[model samples]
Target: PSLSLSHSLSLFLFLSLSRSVLSPPASLIVSPDRSQFFEYESVSLSCEVQGNSARWRLKRSTVFGERSDCGRNWGKPQGSSCIVSLIPSHSGVYCCESGSGEHSNAVNITVHGDRVEEEGG
Candidate 1:
């Protein structure tokens, strides 16, 4: 018995799909990478995927227990990246999520309320 051309092609496609399914999800890259940030600052969040990043979107769960996507009411989406103006309310966990339900590593961000001034005694 011999395999048909269509059968071989189907097998190849299956293997390719299997490899992608087993591969790790995309990663969320943060600019000026740090856990802490001051209020009124800006941060950049982008998705680094195996292929095109346009399939992924930046998401966040704020400290106020609100979940939302970028470019909605939070950050502005520019290409595959999101530019966010930092605020105390923006302190939360951020990550990248694909349309296929794949999620990247989440990052915790903290935005300080205000800078305290020190007085000389």
Candidate 2:
């Protein structure tokens, strides 16, 4: 009887853990399809969330190791999106995160300067 009870308890715990691990996470999609851009051009990083959320924000990481907090707001009933103007300095990986502790995959962006023409005027 003692051995049977222990086995049942162990089985219950294993099943519960498996369910938690296998459950699907909240869905989020970021757009402006390609992640690359030019130095002075404007780029908007937007995301759509599917599921419950408390809040969200757009975070950017520059190639020079600087981080900037672009925008943040309460999550909408149907999800939310934000657009940020791009400058030469705003080049690198960007992503979105929910205040409820959810984060989207990182999108790498490369911003470059225009080529200079060397000639006598």
Candidate 3:
């Protein structure tokens, strides 16, 4: 299959950035390390970096809006993440931003089911 121009450009950019001297973009880390979660639980998404979090606000993309900043109404910004009170509506991709415009790679969060079983013994 032929790659669309937009897809080609995206691939090029992804490759260029991957090879660039710049550090890999920041990342969102989940405490449980599990993408799946039960409803009504607290899900914490922390950034890989510390310090200077004033520029950081959890970002989410939606079908209606390409991107939107997570508001304090849904969760409180603590340290490097927006600690959201997990609900089904919160299931989506999330990322963190810094003052320099360096945004972390997006992480997918799934909030559904009844309860999350602990991993490992």
Q: State which candidate, 1 or 2, has the greater lDDT.
A: 1
TM-score of each: 0.75, 0.58, 0.61
- lDDT ranking, best first: 1, 3, 2
Q: Output candidate 1 Cα RMSD.
A: 4.0
Q: What residue runs in model 1 are displaced by over 4 Å at the alpha carbon?
A: 1-23, 117-121
> How far does residue 97 in candidate 3 sit from its true spot (Å)?
2.2
- Per-residue C-alpha lDDT of model 1 across residues 17-88, encoded as one tens digit per residue: 898778756888899888888888899998889887777878999867899999878899887789999988
Q: 1-121 in candidate 3: lDDT tens per residue?
A: 3569889999999988885436644667777778777787787777776445566667876433557675644667775566777877777777877767777777777777455343322
Off by over 4 Å in 2: 1-31, 72-79, 115-121
Q: What TM-score does structure 2 among the candidates reach?
A: 0.58
Q: In model 3, what is the error at residue 54, expressed in angstroms? A: 3.5
- Candidate 3 stretches with Cα past 4 Å from truth are 1-22, 50-52, 63-66, 113-121
- In order, what lDDT does every prediction score? 0.86, 0.58, 0.70
**Residue 42 accuracy (lDDT) in model 2:** 57
Task: Kindly report which residue pairs in candidate 3 clash with one another.
Answer: none
